[model samples]
Target: MKNLKKKLGLALAVTLSTVTFATAYSTTAEPTTAATSENVNENTIRNDEPTSDRINQFKDIAMYYYWHGGDIQQAEKDIFKGITLKGKYDVVENAFKEATLLDPYDLDLKLSLASTQIIQKKTPEALQTYKQILNLDPNHFNANLLYGVYSKVNGDNSSYKSSISNLKQIDAKKTNEYLQKLETTETILDENLNTSAPADLPQKDHAIVILGYALAEDGSMREPLIERLKAGLAIAKQYPNSKIIVTGGVPKQGITEADAMSNWLISQGIEKDRIILENKSTDTVENGLFSTAILDKEGIKDVTLVTSASHMRRALTVFKEASDFYNKMNGNNIDRNFTNVVYLDYPSLEEAHKVSKDEILVIYRDLIRTSGIWQYPGLQR
Candidate 1:
């Protein structure tokens, strides 16, 4: 019986060691068929879901793309498509809410969602989102910067001050830099708002700047382009000695708007030497930034900014802001003015009515850009 007991104990020990070895092998091995089958089942469910379910699935897909796959642009497009298809602010809010749950630490996701909320006029929701971001990461640079701008636009002076204070504490260099530009913008905006009309043209020695519009597909001068060039020519004729600055860069066919404008102006008997073509700018902000650099280099401080009446507000604001930034950076006190705007009439009243929202948003966006946030690449102009 003692021998039998010893044999049984030996058998139990061998069985236990084998079981342990098998468990270790299972744990260290590559994923098993069960895991693969589970993934397949998930894919099957996703494929079989209804259209709404498929659409809602984008939240998870976007998160995966952003975090796991490291494809930010694709993730952004996926989220954007979800919002676009829904066409409702609440739906967008919900999509962001679900995404945030998946990646609670994602600052970019929070900022994008907040921006969307602001665009949708969901101020309270946006404010909450901003608060959440600040709470998560108190020193988040973009969050603080954009929150300040948005607060100012929303007329929440208290929140704006708080955000600015927080910015100063977290990043004093950026705060001071942005403050200077913000002050310049505020001064210009106040002056602009108080004045009803464009300033009268300076009598002498001031440059004439014609903001270019779109050229035809074949690089031909179109109506508005022709109108703007004509208006600039009239101003040039008035101040024959003053240089003409033609600003635009978007190309058609093979020629830029500035090139088209220059050709048209030369064709209409304007001297080529008197025309300064700024063919590097792509948008109004670039137009202002690039044109001002040339103006400063040429010692042209006073300018008669000419564009369509609908565009005058934004164009003038951007020009003034750019000029202010240029002057501040160069330590030169130049008196930049947009006193004279030769209005190129819009095609019709309907087109004119399409101006206000776009104009205001551009002005606000450029002001933020001028404040040293979201700066484009290049010479920091």
Candidate 2:
């Protein structure tokens, strides 16, 4: 009876072992469908952030080119497509917002967004953005300029007055120094022009023509045309083997002052090859920047700036600063000097009085420039 019981228990154990082995094999088996893995990858591409990230990189490149005059509308469209294509405006808004978070010190991004806000007429949002900018860089020139515009547009007289006052206080020393040098050069130039035998004027290696406040109606350098042309031409003549750049855009109703100046110079025996006309600039800053491009293109090394005695000071500062930025970026150096070509044509006592009055006005206008007129035009106080 004991042997019979032992046989029965062994058979039961074998049956239980077979059942357990079958269950274990089922649990260890993997799903065999390739479609599941592909679905996972597709979900990752749609839900993952790589697409948005690529869009941002492309947007930055677009903005860089846009700032250099390479098509801003296209850049804006590209950025719009990048953010909206993913059905994630939040992602883009967050990306720009977080750039500020990662580096709260990034004033450029802050100001850019703030400017957009102002453009959209979102006054409150723009105010907040300006506040953020001020927190980062209180002395940010363009920020203050826009803030003034903001206040002015919103009827915040107190804020506008304060901003204008602040602009006037920033830095008048550089302007004053340039004005002084211009005065000296003009005095010397005038004495030489009037003298029976021209005084031995200082020589330079190149000439810089500054287009100031656009051309006047008569194809002259605004109200004080002769002085600017005189100073610039004097420098070109002083500099042997050097040329004069007469810069201005097409005049409002007629030919440009550049063309008029060219005609006048040729009549005075100055050869056409010695005169270079930069007739595309509509503003003072462009006068320097585009002229620099021409100089670089021509492989001309030395530079001398010629403008109105009143206008020369500011021109010098802008010209020098821009030239430095350009050279640093291009990784090259050109021999350059921004000597004032003083137009000594203050012929009449009455004319001198008029110039003095104009000088006072010029000083005030120049003081307003620290606020960045180009960026915030409405704030040009």
Candidate 3:
């Protein structure tokens, strides 16, 4: 849950957490007429971008490493089956450097590198990547939006203002709309993060919303998820009268995350009648939307969201957006915000507070999708 979710989010906050993702983009330049096939083959492993076929092959290798949190050795062993010309990259950063060197003009790849750098606490390097991204394409939508948010969060008003100007000029309607929603989400995030998970919550309209993690292939709970469940159990006992909602639909070996979570809670002495199961969602976005719909039907208003600290921000933001959407649809005056959250620090709490660049990017990305800006299924970039 903790760093695992964030690490997964680093790829595409809104994509397959444990699945491979190779976006259909070719960054390789066409071979020059004067260059021989031998020269091209030699240069493919060097700085020049390879042919489209070669880039696709590289993607299968690189994304598997990313999916496994940069376990390059395993990626090479599994994806390539004992072949990678770049040799052993002991660090994830080196893998990123290798990818960028091979496909220097890929904006999405650069963003991924910047995100990894930011997560690794290489702020100056990440910032330089952002500069390089802007240089590559001045009007890149995601680049400007994220750069703006990064600048604002880091107290660089100059960059933030400059970004805002660029965004407004780029697409005033869409950018302004997203910016407005961003303000609302930021307020919710700041207020909730400052406040601790309550010792007691009102029972009349409150529910402990526990966002679920995927189960092991054999349907057993992983350590991170077990930690989250432990935290949720504590919260449930504290607010014994409140309802509990476990949300996740991804199943492993025929066992859904919600079903396994509910079963565990039942085994731990929680009544089945008290726990509401949202077992149809495949990802966080669906968790928010489907869970909010269930809450609406049950007449629940206040919610205390429970998840890992790495996932808390995105969950809170997306849930808030979904809640607002549902409230507007139902014409209810109740403000349904995930303002109260309990986060399990999987590795440590200190690391959870440091939001990665990918998480920051996806908060808005998911919010916009929850806002109905995009109708597509998976995240594009």
Candidate 4:
């Protein structure tokens, strides 16, 4: 009876241990199995779901971070991280592509995507995207303008003419003016194609116009502004007789770009009377428009325009176009020639292999504005 009792107790102990071990095993295994199953389900859904649905989902997430989150900087960072940081162009392209799928009516997104495609050298894709934009808004200013410029650059003269015609319907006065300038440009291009002329340096006695950049938040000159100023100063020193015009506005609280430029030039020993302050213009288009008015008042016909290299092409084009319009409006068309403006490129701190698509798009926009297709917002006369 003693031996039977011992054996029965041992068996009970064994049974309890097995049960405990099984319980512990299940506790660990069940959660892991559940987690794996969840992951698999997600993968399956991603694979099986329609692309449009997935695109909408991604766009919804992007919109949440872009607007509802109230953190635009963070949103831009997240959206552009793949491209800006990792140089993963495909990732950003895909994101924009997906986002556009859900919001086909968003003109801005389409423009952005098309610009990115151009930057990537995907010309065919960009053309298709531009076509899509036109389908949505046939007379979209930016779309037609950019498409025209792109077509012109790619040597598609037929498309270029078509785009110009479209623009004419949108703004006839501006289109006529731009068409004249376009013909002039083509003539110059033809001349250049036949014979390369020696590069002519800027004349020292020409009026010097220093284009303004944004000032630092503390009212100090930002590096870009300082660089522009430095270039202006050098030119001013070289051309003591030339009148200097500094163009910019008080975009921040403390001071205007013109003010900073004027102060810097004064400190460098330029006379106050020689410097003209144009502090009301906010953007490049306004810079050209306002500065041209000043030039008209001063009876100045020639100018040496100074700005960053990355911005040089647009700046030169707008200033020339603005001056032409001003001349025509004021009936000062004795020669019908645009202003004799020369460009001086101040290299930007950022290095790029080629001009970016964004820059090109901005050039087109400014060109359209200069053509008088659209007036500056809140502009008086």
Candidate 5:
């Protein structure tokens, strides 16, 4: 009877050991589902059931959110998180590769990978990635755009020229599409410009007007600039406005356009109270954004955003996008809100010399404006 009890006890020990081992193995080596296509049924994605499908759903959600809100960094982070949370790097890499394979026609993924490689300073890899994109799509607009940007960043002027050349080769209809976008932008701007703000247009009590970018140190006002500023100041002067934020930092550290403009405007005998000097914004976007902040803090809301007539569309867009005018009025609960704005233009005489190249410039300018996050947000027009 004692021997029988000893054998039973040994069998219990064996059973417990097997159970523990199984538990440990199950915990450590969990079956990981890859965030890949074949492993995930596309239909299951909408239901969010399978692990891979859930990951895909997360990716789609993140992408949609980012696209609408203009939040790319967040999108990238979310995508990386969704893939990596599966606890597999190879799986993530394979997913990215599978994405490229599945949509062999799409260069965005390839371009994204190339941009990542460029950021990591992996030039050879970036080059290979771009080459692969070019192999798949010889005339991909984004590929050319990024190639030009990378070339310019790396001082590869030869490559830049090649990329620019390739961009020029886009068919007329596609080029027209870009132009139509600009035309639509201009239509909105013109509609806004030609109309008077509501009877309760916010009055700028002590606002500043910053004369943005223009040719440096040119003594005389260019015709376009003159016409634009004249129209702008005429409308603004009707509002009993107190100050002008004349701002422009030197693109090159010589006599800045802002100083020249201030001197010229003051020479016209505009009161010193009317001009608040801000001779320190190098680019148009900075001129608008930084000036908006400064003026907003000073309790000024009505602004005449003076720039070339040609630049009014972009300037207005930037102000709309970046300025605190909207938030400040709503935050302070100030019923007497003022977001009044105007545009000016001053195309240089030197433009006459380049009249022959206007067609080319028009195309190249639009391409450059649309291809990247330019220094000025709305200046594409």
Candidate 6:
């Protein structure tokens, strides 16, 4: 739990840095209008001023906890008294429920609420929410896509079949080609299930890429990152000829994740030339987008990815798609083989088993973003 808190807190801090919403809203400021995905001229806001402010406040708080990864200690801090991490989904649900009551036509808010419902594994509630969104606009991209994915995952074929057209309408970014190659959680888990590294991988023309996690405010390596570095060190020792690439761009105080990772690797006796710093990416998706181009330049053929098991599926998919994206632009099929060295972020094997499927399903949201649709459908990448 000590390690978990450090990891989650750093993530929250980074997310907080990017927050654009008003943390405090005027209690007397009335809800003059509500905007949907299209932001048409419809103005359906009917709530009192106080209620409008309350739901926005609740939405902000829910976002905080969502980024907090449900860490109990952080949830208790600030003015968030009486709210433990366990109540995170409840808070999220309440926020959406109130906001929807204020303006039933706000498709964006409804989508966010449906997303939270999915995270909480409230299938009935989530389906209802998605249905509500679809009822409002049958062509809504996110709602149709999510509803399709969730239905297929739960073995409901009819809804999934009907939603493909709407899902395919929004953003493909020419990435529709790689959709066939995307590995589901069911396909890859059995082979990469171990948290330990394999020793027999080839060294030449291969690279060991370490993904970065958020760092402490003072630029110190948190326990989880050090653990990943230690694992990278072991891989470096085992495959002495393999190049090491550390990718992260988010800085704290002054040091970037790549700088910190490279320094740590060199301190552990790894050669300086063997370690490459990719300090331009801000997130896992960007890590894929930026690092693959560098790999192509260095003539690296096969790549092994080192990330927490919690992040492995999404990271793999993103990097694979990144490689595909670059190849599509250059018209050269660069060989990008991704092998995984999974770090067990769960407290126990039992818990990992229990949550793995849900983790797999939840990654579709990020997958959609990777395919060029931003969180809100109106914003395209």
Minimal lDDT window, size 10, model 1: 24-33
How much lDDT does each candidate structure score? 0.62, 0.49, 0.66, 0.60, 0.46, 0.67
TM-score of 6: 0.67
Query: Which 10 successive residues of model 5 have the least lDDT summed?
Result: 4-13
Q: What does candidate 1's lDDT look like per residue over 140-241, in tens digits?
A: 876787777777776788988999999999989978977876676555443322112234556565788889887776888777777767777777876777
Which stretches of model 5 miss by more than 4 angstroms?
1-190, 195-210, 216-221, 232-237, 251-253, 324-381
Runs of candidate 3 exceeding 4 Å displacement: 1-50, 69-71, 74-106, 118-121, 192-206, 213-243, 249-256, 279-286, 293-300, 308-314, 324-334, 339-381
- Per-candidate TM equals 0.62, 0.43, 0.62, 0.56, 0.39, 0.67
- For residues 284-368, could you state the per-residue lDDT of candidate 6 as single tens digits? 7788888987998998878888888777777777777677778878898776777888677888755554545466665665565
Candidate 3 clashing pairs, residues 3+ apart or interchain: none
Give me candidate 2's TM-score against the actual structure: 0.43
lDDT of 1: 0.62
- Model 1 segments beyond 4 Å from truth? 1-132, 171-180, 190-205, 216-222, 344-358, 375-381
Model 3: lDDT of residue 322: 85
Candidate 3 yields a Cα-based lDDT of 0.66
Model 4 ranges with Cα > 4 A deviation: 1-70, 73-146, 154-158, 161-176, 183-206, 334-361, 374-381
Better of 3 and 4 by lDDT: 3
What is the alpha-carbon lDDT of model 4 when measured against the actual structure?
0.60
lDDT of 5 by residue, 126-240 (tens): 6677778777787877666556645554557788777767767965555544445444444434434332223443454645354555653344445554544454455445655
lDDT (tens digit, per residue) of candidate 2 on 1-381: 222212211221222233322222121112221232323432111223343332333223223222222222332333233433221223223334544554567676565455445434556677788777877777776576667656655668698667656655664553343344334434422321221113343344445554544556455555466656555555455554667787776575578767877877777667898888887765566666778778777766556565554455556555654565467668988646545554434564334334343343233233334223433222111
Better of 5 and 6 by lDDT: 6
